[model samples]
Target chain A: MLTAIAIVIIGVLLFLANMFMDNYQLRILNLSGIYIILSLSMILINGFLGLFSLGHAGFMAIGAYTVALLTTPPMAKQMNYYLDPIVPWLAETEWSFLPAILLGGVLAAIAGFLIGAPVLRLRDDYLAIATLGFAEIIRIVFTNLQSVTNGSLGLKGLPEIEIEIPLPLIGFTLNLSACIWIAAIITILFMVRLVNGSYGKAFKAIREDEIAAEAMGINVFKHKLLAFVIASFFAGVGGAFLGNIMGTVDPLMFRFLLTYNIVLIVVFGGIGSLTGGVLAAIVITAAMELLRFLDSSFDMGPIAVSGIPGLRMVVFSLLLMFIIIFKPRGIMGVREFSWQWLIELPQSIKNSSFGRKKLRKDVSK
Target chain B: MSLLRTENMTMRFGGVVAVSDLNVHLDKNEIIGLIGPNGAGKTTAFNMISGVYKPTVGKIILGKEEVQGGQTVTVEKDITGMKPSAITKLGIARTFQNIRLFKELSVLENVVIANHLRLESNWVSSVVRTPDYTKKETAMYDKSMALLEKVGLAELKDEKSYSLPYGMQRRLEIARALATKPHILLLDEPAAGMNPQESDELMRFIGKIRDEFDLSILMIEHHMQLVMGICERIYVLDYGITIAEGNPYEIQNNPKVIEAYLGVDD
Candidate 1:
């Protein structure tokens, strides 16, 4: 019951913020929500299944291009495809944002199934390399599919997602960021339910020890494939949301760097902790935005450091290195945030200080 | 009639014959021991029976069911070369030579995972948390708790499995195997690191579980006292060859068994 109320309050706060925040701030918020979905998906594959998959950018590209192709207006399609002219059927076709987004996820899942069948068999570093290769292959494929993806020129003028609250007294409108937030919340809830189930245990079992999990009657390959496909589906959904929010997409947008950013979120969060991932996603996205000034020329009181083209990324890389050295398990480790922890916090604090003082007094006695 | 029988089971790893022409039979509720020195292929036999390694040449049959015509028949399925999980589903559960509990998981989770094989609900119902899935999960939870209690680990059900004491970790692994609801239990070196006194306690514990769970057990143990104390029959292997198969007394008096353990008389 407490959780239900907390969710409602958070939901209301986000809705209110949507109404008040400027467009740029809302864009960053939407981007954070997208990152939350992406990071959660990465956690499923990399953390839970113990598969170090680096092909998320590929899946996201599939999703983004799928949504772009399906939802872009015919006029925009004509303009984007001026050199190559999109396939005749795609040029005439259009779909609403929801179905297009879901289709994107479905296509990505299908791709996951096909790719996972071959590569999920590989272990550890080999799997990572294979998946990374697949991502590059996907990006290259999208680049060359001139009639389908409009070559490197990319797809532009995609529709924005806007929803109006259907209430009698207050008809409030939700823009793209609010829609993305809703999607992220749905993703979070879905993931929480999934990880709490027996399948989740099985995934963890696989992660802990694949041989033992198989001995205990879990079909390891099947479960690994299941996790991979599900992660790919969500990656696709996040990608669709990203394209919709940006109002355009290109093959270049879905690069290895895109996947690396998602990985950064997953690592900064505790790998197996959903709450940690969600919190890290928002914090990291906001931090990245806040640190944007670092990328530009700034006078640091006494010394003026000329703007380094990728100074923001350098700072993040240093932060990641620090995290790896000092806190290998990240913020929360494998443990999740719970109400029980909150309830025990005060008592634990008292025990720490008071118990120490009492011990000192006893020693004096 | 034997509950499980192996026919001419042989496993050769390239140039080395790990277990050669081995035949074993396990009856219902029988406790058998596979005792051998290091590298003697005792674990190889267990691996074959548990479907971890497929015999290069062999047939492993399980279950002797009485058909409608009053004819006794072996289950007719040769489980050789089957996947480990499928064999586990067919009512064969085994513990590792070293304790292989899901160490990071809670004690209850370690047991509950074994029950996953019998779960009727799939991932779809799990996502939506349908009533059927919830009911199954509740039942699994209750069953796992009961199993933990029977194994004397109920109080520590919420503790991480690796946090348990060494002896308790062994017991928890047994509890995990038992949760699979297997008719036959294969234990690999259950008494490996225990002292004499602890092994004695483990002997009694093993006998108690055998009767309580109505299981046929095949164990690979380096500890003779526990094996001789509990096992009804023993098979001794040396260098992938069966040297002796008999009751404890017959094996104690056998010269071949002695030579296998002690080197052939100077």
Candidate 2:
């Protein structure tokens, strides 16, 4: 019940924020929402199922390209696919954002199932390397599939989705930012429901001990595949949202660095904690934006200096290092931020630090 | 006839024969012991029977066995090469020698996860929490709680399984196996680390559960006291071959059993 109330409150706040925030702020908000979806989905596989997957970027590329191709106008496709005309069927057809995004997610899920079928059987580092290799293969495939993905030139001028709901009072346009957050909220609710259910327990069971889990009648491979496919589905959707938000996408955009960033978020948050994932996603996304200045080249007196290409990631790497050193279990460990925890937060904070300080002061006196 | 029978089951790991042509039968509600020294292929046999290792040769059959009629064991399912989970669904459940409880999970959750084998609702229904799923979940919760109560871990249902004392952890593992509602239960060294007093309690606990759950138990234990006290029949293996199979008294008096255990009288 508290969860539902909190979600509603967050929805209302996002709605208000949608109306009030400027374009630049709203872009960050949308990016944060996209990160939330990506990190939470990654958590389902890497954290919950104990499968170390580094192929999220590949799935995202599939989604972004699918959404881009399906939603772009026929004239736009003709202009975009100049070197090699898009396949006739794709060039002529256009779809609304919802169907395109759903198709993107479904395609990505299918890809996930195919890759996971063989790769999920491998454990730990082998799984990670295989998945990372698969992602690279996907990116390279997109690069070479000239007629389909417009080769390395990439896709641009993708339409922003604006959903309008007619209410009794007035009709409000659900802009791209609003759509991203709405998608994120739905993704979160789905993840929460899944993690709290029997299937979630089974996933965790696999994480705990694959051999025991199989002995207890969980088809370990099946559960691992299920988690991988579902995570890929949401990652695909997140990718679609990101592409629409940026209004452009290329093969270069979906790289191992993308997967690395999301993995960092999942790690910085507690791996198995959904609330921690959410907190880390937002904090990391905002922090990355805040640290953008570090990457920006400033005008020196005489010499011209180009910005450092990936300074934000370096800063984030340091931040993650500090997190690993200080709070090895990440922010929340495996514990969630529940309403009961919220109620006790003040007491806990006092007892852990302030109360200890007071006792030390008294002893000193 | 037996509830479960292994016919010429053998497992050869490349050059080494781990278990050679091992034939064993378990009757309904019978307590059978597989006893051997360390590395005597007892666990290897358990592994083959529980579908962890597919036997290099022979069949494992599960079906009805009329104790009084002396009929042939009916060939219901030849689960020789099935996956462990599928074998479990066919009513075989097991506990690890090392107490492989889902350690980070709660005691109740450890048991509830076993119930997942028999879940009727799919992930979609469970996630949506439809009426059917909720009813199933509630029933699963109740069943898990009842099992915890039976094992005396009801109070610690919310505590992490790893936090429980050693004896309680063993009991929780048995409770978890019981939650799967298996007809055949394989316990791998249930009394491994227990003190004599605790093993005594475990003996009674094992007997009580066999009667209560209508289960045939196959256990591997080095604790001879517990084995002798509880097991109606015992199989002794040495170097991957069965050295003796008889009633505990008969096995105790067997020259071959003594030779194997005492090194052929020097």
Candidate 3:
């Protein structure tokens, strides 16, 4: 019941913010939603399944390019020389935002299935290296595909998605930000339902022991492939949102840094916890924005210190190192946020008043 | 009729012949004991029957399959070269000598996963978590719990498998193998590290399960007392070849068996 109340409150706040906030704040919120989706995708593979895949950015590239090619207007095809006559039917077809995004996800899933077939056979550091090589290969393919991806020049002038809802008191207005936020919330809810299911249990089992899982008739390879495909599908959708939001698609945009950033976010949030992933995405996204303020000089009473140009990254790296040494499992460990925590919250509050009694009980126990 | 029969099975790892011309047969509703000193190829024979290692030369027939023609039959249906998973689906299941339970998962989850092979639900049903899948999952949980209870591990159902006491871990391993509902079960040194009391209890537990599940068990044990107590028929191996096979009375009095155990009696 408390969870329901919290959901309702959060929904109301999002709706109000969408209605009242300026375009700049709305854009930041949309970025947060995108990060949430990407982080959840990472959690599915790395956290639950214990597969070290550094090729998420490769899947995202496939998604971004797919969306870009399918959704580009016929008139603008001439301007984008890289847009070939391949899949001409889709180019001529006009799909709404949702189906196009879903198609992008499906394409990415296919890519994941193909890659996971052979690579999932490798173990530990070997799997990591294989996935990293796959990502590098994907980047190179995009860069060299002059006819389809426009080479390094990139694609531009794609149509922006506009979401509008008719309200009784107010006039109908464009609300793309609301749509992105809604997609993010839906993704989170879907993942929560999935990870709580039997398939999720199988994935965790394979992670713990592949040989034992197989003896138990798990079809270990099949479960691992499922995890990879599902994770890649979400990554593709997130990539499509990013491409549409930025109004451009370039091979150069998907660098190794993008994959590294998402991996860092997943590790910082705690693996295998969807709630932790979402929370980490929000915190990291906001922190990156806030660090921009440090660019200007600040004066103290007796001294002044300007923000060093590359100091932010150094500080961030240090924070990662510190977290690994102190809390290797991250902030939440493998636990999700449950209603049990809320139930215990009031008890903790009451215990503060009778602290001595609580202490005595603890010692006795 | 024998449920599993391996004729002239031989496995060679490069220059080292681990098991040579090993002939073994397992009848239905029987417990067979495999005893040997270290490096006597007891595990190698088990591995060959379980399809972990393809025998260099042999015929392994499961469920009355025939052996036609010469020593080498070229039929594609040979069970000797099949994968371990395929062999398991053919009513053969084994526990590792080292206790390879899925350590991070709970004991219940581990056993339930083993029960998944018999489930009628397909991949689509599992992904959507359909009502049918949920029902099957519930049934599997109940059955797995029952097995755990039978093995005296009902209290550790929710604990991570690796966190259980060593004796409980062995019991859980057997419970997991039984979850596969195999016609024949292979236990690799189930009493490896148990105390005498635990070993005695394990002997009784093995007998009870054999009767209850109607299973054919092939176990490798170094503990002679446990072997003598539980096994209906025993096979003693020396250097990859069976030296003696008979009832407990015959085995205890055989000169060759006595020599094998007592180092030739000087």
Task: Give the DockQ (2 decimals) of all models.
Answer: 0.85, 0.87, 0.50
lDDT of 1 by residue, B1-266 (tens): 78888998999999999998888999989999998879999988989998889999989988745575787665656899899999999889999988898989999999999999999888989999999899999999999999988889999999999999999999999999899899899999999899998899999999999999999999999888888889999999988888899999988889988888887855
Model 3 Cα lDDT, one tens digit per residue, B59-108: 89886334676453322235888777778877788888899998877888
lDDT of all predictions, in order shown?
A: 0.90, 0.91, 0.83
Candidate 2 residue A297 C-alpha distance from true site, Å: 4.8
Give the Cα error of residue A299 in candidate 2, in Å: 11
Find the 10 residues in a row with the least total lDDT in model 3 chain A: A82-91
Best by TM-score: 1
Stretch of 10 with least lDDT, candidate 1 chain A: A157-166
- Model 3: per-residue lDDT, tens digit, A297-353? 766567887766766666677878887999898888888898898779877766776
CAPRI-wise, candidate 1 is high
Best by lDDT: 2
Per-residue C-alpha lDDT of model 2 across residues A82-110, encoded as one tens digit per residue: 79988988988788778889999999999
Candidates, ranked, DockQ: 2, 1, 3
| Chain A TM-score values for every predicted structure, listed in order | 0.94, 0.92, 0.87
Clashing pairs in 2: none
